[model samples]
Target: MSKSGNPTLIIASFFSIYVIWGSTYLLNKIAVTELPPFMLASIRFTTAGVLIFILAKFLGINLAISRKQFLNTVIAGFLFLTFGNGVVVWALRYVDSGFAALEISAQPLIVLLLMRILQGKKIKLMSMIGVILGIIGVYLLVSQKAIINQENSIAGMIMIFMCMLSWAYGSLFVSKADLPSNYFVNTGYQMVTGGILLLLTSFIFGETWTSPMVWSTPVQYTMILLIVFGSIVAFTSFNYLLKVVSPEKVATSTYVNPIIALTLGWYFLNENITVQSMIAAVVLLTGVYFINTKKKLLIFSRFSGRLSKKLK
Candidate 1:
């Protein structure tokens, strides 16, 4: 348990990320069936961003940001949301939501390797083992004949992997970039900017747009849930957890989210959860655990602790 904050709040925060974020895959899958992907993401983030600013005002948090910080937020927004999330939503049209979630679960592995390549950081022996296992797991997951045989499945998988790279690079950039001191304010800026960019992308791609009133009932409900819970509430909890708990502990969401996604996809969407995917998920999550596990690296602990505090 974390040494700070109420235990109940901490538990609730964990639940938000573990379950709410996990369920987003299913919700998005449902929505994208009826709505255009980029347009859907644009509306969700824009609405959520506006709502966040309203909440911040109610809380009396400062929203002023420097130009440099604004630029950083835009860059982060593009990498994390515009490209990273928007493309994934688009790809969901071609791939199962569970499979997409499972593939994204390898993000930790991507981040670890990115740190090594970009920052010249040394990978510990345990992390090296994790890298090997992650590669094998990914191979197992993507190599299955059933998945590859599906139309556009290969394209979807490839694009999702590219989005992971974008997200991984964005993670590295944010660790050093200057941004709003308040996490809520910072996230609001990112959401707004990212959403705007997504809207532009939608226009460029000639995606059809429709009013919320005309949307199907399920899509309407999904959009509301996505904006309220997935983007705002869950993200707030994620930032809160980073402040109160060790990141490795917060990262337990990585393990639980895909399980929730897989089960929900199977139950609600009738998406297949093949035996190979299950095996890959286990191996991949195990590798993520190994990569996140620490052994008294005082320097990293101090750095991450400071980063977490500053991020809030």
Candidate 2:
């Protein structure tokens, strides 16, 4: 893709990552209602991974990688997709999709903190303010009576937080890891490895597996969308945008995704959106914006460019 791509294509790619990626929370919520979380995620990703390989072959993209790169991809797949994504799907059973999206919006904050603790990176003044507001926003979001009152919600929230840590560390790891040069090839390896791990998890947990034929129509449709759009199309668009536009411009999805997820969950699942949630969303997104402000010493943006690749 050229750096100066067609304007219409640029707009469409942005739409894919912003809207389509956001809707995945709702899609997972709907699917998890009928299928076991790991199983659902396994099926979706394994199929998508194979499809990606086929597409890469057709496009004449090389699929070979060193053993070291393969191992790194395995680790990354486990961190980013197997645990980061699959566990969130499990959490969906207890938490509302919108609520989950809102909570996950604090990821940049977590990444910043991890960088400080792990790498001894100094946080900029603006990023420090973002951290403070992010904390308040998170407290406001999770402390809601309506949300906490739900059974298992606390566990779900805690697990989701752990997943954020996994993703944050994964982001840091990916920045330095020697992986496939082609984005498509890298993602294909990660999805395939991650999907295999999820399959193993499902078996270990004794989650019942059933044929798609028996799935409800809505669930079948959701699976199709998740596999085709959520995993494949949105990811492809993300890579395209990263090549054609500035990372800062592509990073706007960080702010837009949660809002889209919240709206869709409210409209389709009738998930309640309290006034506090709205307030928290604004504050949280503002914090993210502040943290993402361009700076010479900003490590967040450097890792974030890698982070956004796997964040759907």
Candidate 3:
């Protein structure tokens, strides 16, 4: 890879988002088995946040910022990490990581619609079709009856949808916000603020949190892995990506993650992927693909309104 403009870094960043973040879903699923959802996230963010800040200062990355920027970054963190990621942790108690992955894959579709609403971007007709298909897929996936889920699945589905929604909104808002010129320094503040909020929420909710030493060995390892790889490494890569690449390009990771999660969940966690889930995954992912790509793509999307009209 040419080092011109650090293309390698970009590719590596994308890979990190795809593989590392993808795996985090399963990692989180495992961690929450013994750890409370809020606290699990608190630990990951707080540790990662502090480390990022220290590294930034050590590297001579300036941390100075206006009050407005600080508030915006932290608020974005609260929305994305706290409400978005935090809720997914809670939902895992009822939902399988694979199922949650499928739901989270809808992030691109949600972001597309949010951009149309928030930024006045004109969405193509085929993109609308894509969005509609994604909705149907998610509905089918969630509505299909499963013995393991019982009734909590309904609440689980709702919470995961909220996670997607919160994450989508955060992405949109963060793009528009002015933060530190250095992405690492800016992200550090967000993580710290978000982690603090999560800790406070854990306290308020009385989550029956346990000390890490008391947790099982597996949980301990998972927590450690999340802090190091998932939060610090993947998040730094993601922040770098946001600064360099088109948001649409970065969003492609959403498509990849669910597949990784589904495969890992089946292989390691033995989570069931029903016929409905498989079909849902295909439909949902295909729709998301269309939403991200231009008018020229696999069959159906190739004839998106503009192209069809041009042909006619």
Candidate 4:
């Protein structure tokens, strides 16, 4: 491929990640209807883990790891998939898919803050401003419902936010840990470890499984497709994009996911998308763009460039 093709590939890969992942929130909502929350998440990761491992094996990918690396990978799985995505799946029971997406979309902000506090890195002022704006946007999204219903969907939202932090931590671990060079191999390990842990937790929590012969048959198939396409294909392609694309472009996926989730929720579940929700989306996207593209903010970028370089 020509050098020029590289950017195009990156852009395309990013679009894929954004659009595909955005839809997963609705997928979770649908899948959870037929499957118990924990079991549903457990099955999705396990299937993805098994499939990815088989594919990696077929492609001559190595799965072996040092004792330290193995432990790190397992711990990573617990943090990332277990705590991050697992909580989102768990919360879908209590929130709309669109709402669930908006809540979890707080991820970039959480990641930014976590990196600063945990890693002793400084956040760019513009990024900090962006986080503030994004938080405000989230507040707007739920403000009316909060006032009208007097319910604390705040707890559910906080769970998803924590999901973001755990995911960020797991990602940091992946970057810093001593693991095999092959990305697929490492991912397979993480998936297997994470999936098994989720399964064990499901058992401990008494999650029951049902046969395929159910009216909500789509849920089972949805979970399968989600694991196969969403977890495996979308995520692996995301890694490919990060390798080839500018971080700014890849980060755009964070903004795009809410749109995808909202549209999918509308189509599949007959969910309503209100004007206020659209406003919330705009605010969230703007905030995320600001946070992720702090380089464009000039002075703040200069101050935080060293820290940015380390996180990236």
Candidate 5:
């Protein structure tokens, strides 16, 4: 195995993704108050893309991927960033941050099912159980304090659900697509392409601002933090994990991000946590563990059996 595949690097990647990504929801919430959600998302990604692209060049990385690979990356980028994250930013204007989170948390379960339907992958029984548990967990999580209050705009809820679906499809496509061999170059293209799409959509929808940037103190800090940690560090780590781990395992971050969002929301915004929140977090984590572990173990056992026969 390459040095990058060592357990320490893998564990670091996991933590980087969990902590940074989990924190983004709250940062996004803060940014939305001062910036039009679409505009903010566009700027955030644009900045990140430019920075990454510059860095890749300085490091002497050749990003001259094939035309077919470029097209696939563009499609993946549009699905993931433009539709997935862009919709969330827009939805936040109408929905509570926590409620928006609960909806997005459904992504892993949705991805699991989509892989079965679209990729024709066999759904292991344990992972299927995880999916079932996750559904129940989501019900409990959202039902708590009516996580999504009916008073919350129905349009907002639908948009966030669409975000989840977009991310799911994008992730599935990433697994199948012939992407760039280098992680940094591919991510750079994705960020740039996706951010441009986001900006174009925002313009088409007439989302604009008359004032030069003005943000509340907390929002300003949040924006900086998101640009530095969320877009750069977290996204890079996510791409790294996708390279080292199985996609399904990397996808487990979806199950974990909500918990991080819940904690940060309660800490920073004084959002209330409920009994149901605890229950749902437990169910969802349990489900994720079951789904990933069983499949991993099965593969390990098969490898071990083959090795034993050869040794004998």
Candidate 6:
């Protein structure tokens, strides 16, 4: 970690991700209390995107993108933000934020599966075990809670599951696609594209910004927090980490964020946490750890070789 970058900056960036990104879930719940999910998210992302773009321009960053590149950014944005983020916010209406975060924490497992299916990569034995454990963890997490907030927890889990899939594909696509060199600028374009898509989607769903006049003080603050800390600060930190540290190290945030979100939900919203939920969190995060770690122990390498020989 020390060799990766300035040790202080790395610690600060990790802290930003661990706490700020984690808190976004709770903030989303607060915002959705009064604002419709699509409209709220559109506002959040658009404002942040525009601001970031302007800042990038002021910093003399190249903002030029070709038509094809722009379209890729748009498609990636729809996958990453419109579908990925919008659904999570919408599901918050039906689900506890903690549960939703846990579902998202299983994304590494989903990404591994997608890599195998879409790209023909072989799934290693340890990674296969990680995927199975992730599935079981999610099953245990959602089994006990059938309904929440008068909506189906099963449906919420399904939506969040889709969110993970969208993010997984979006990330994979972005990695292969032609994107801007500057991470901040690329992210800004994606955000703006997603915000526009969400705005159109809001109209399609007949979602009106009818509650602006009646929006609570807390809701307003929640929106500000999301735009400032959640979108700007935390996202910048994440991008910074990607540039300076190994992605595997940064991936640990998936596990930490859920723990922080669960604690906050229980502390602030008085959300009930069962023994099963705790155990499931442990299982899910452990699965994520396995998927993220690139190092192979001798046992797994030998076992994989033996299995391949037998199969051949």
Q: What is the C-alpha RMSD, rounded to one decimal, of candidate 1?
A: 7.6
lDDT of 4 by residue, 112-175 (tens): 7766887877887678778888988888887756423635456666677778778666655555
| TM-score comparison, 3 vs 4, better candidate | 3
C-alpha TM-score for every candidate: 0.88, 0.87, 0.91, 0.85, 0.86, 0.87
Q: What is the C-alpha lDDT profile of model 1 across 1-312, one tens digit per residue?
A: 333777998889899989999999999999999999999999999899999999999999989999999999899889978999999999999999999989988888888788788888889877887878889889999999999999999999999999989977876676567777687898899899999999999999999999999998999999999999999888767656655665446656878889999999999999989889989998998888878877534556788899999999
Clashing residue pairs in candidate 2 are none
- Write model 6 residue lDDT over 2-43, tens digit each, in one string: 325678988999998888989999999888877889999899
Residue pairs clashing, model 6: none
What 10-residue stretch in candidate 3 is worst by lDDT? 1-10
What is candidate 1's CA lDDT for residue 104? 88
In candidate 5, how many clashes are counted?
A: 0
List residue ranges in candidate 3 displaced over 4 A. 1-5, 147-149, 295-312
Question: What does each candidate score in C-alpha RMSD?
Answer: 7.6, 7.9, 3.4, 6.1, 5.1, 4.3
- Model 6 TM-score on a 0 to 1 scale: 0.87
Best by TM-score: 3
The per-model lDDT (C-alpha) reads 0.87, 0.87, 0.84, 0.74, 0.78, 0.82
| Model 4 misplaced regions, further than 4 Å | 1-13, 146-152, 213-215, 239-251, 299-312
**Candidate 5 clashes between residue pairs 3 or more apart in a chain or in different chains:** none
Residue-level error in angstroms, candidate 5, position 237: 1.7
Tens digits of lDDT, candidate 2, 88-115: 9999999999999889888888888887
Point out where model 1 deviates above 4 Å. 1-12, 239-252, 295-312
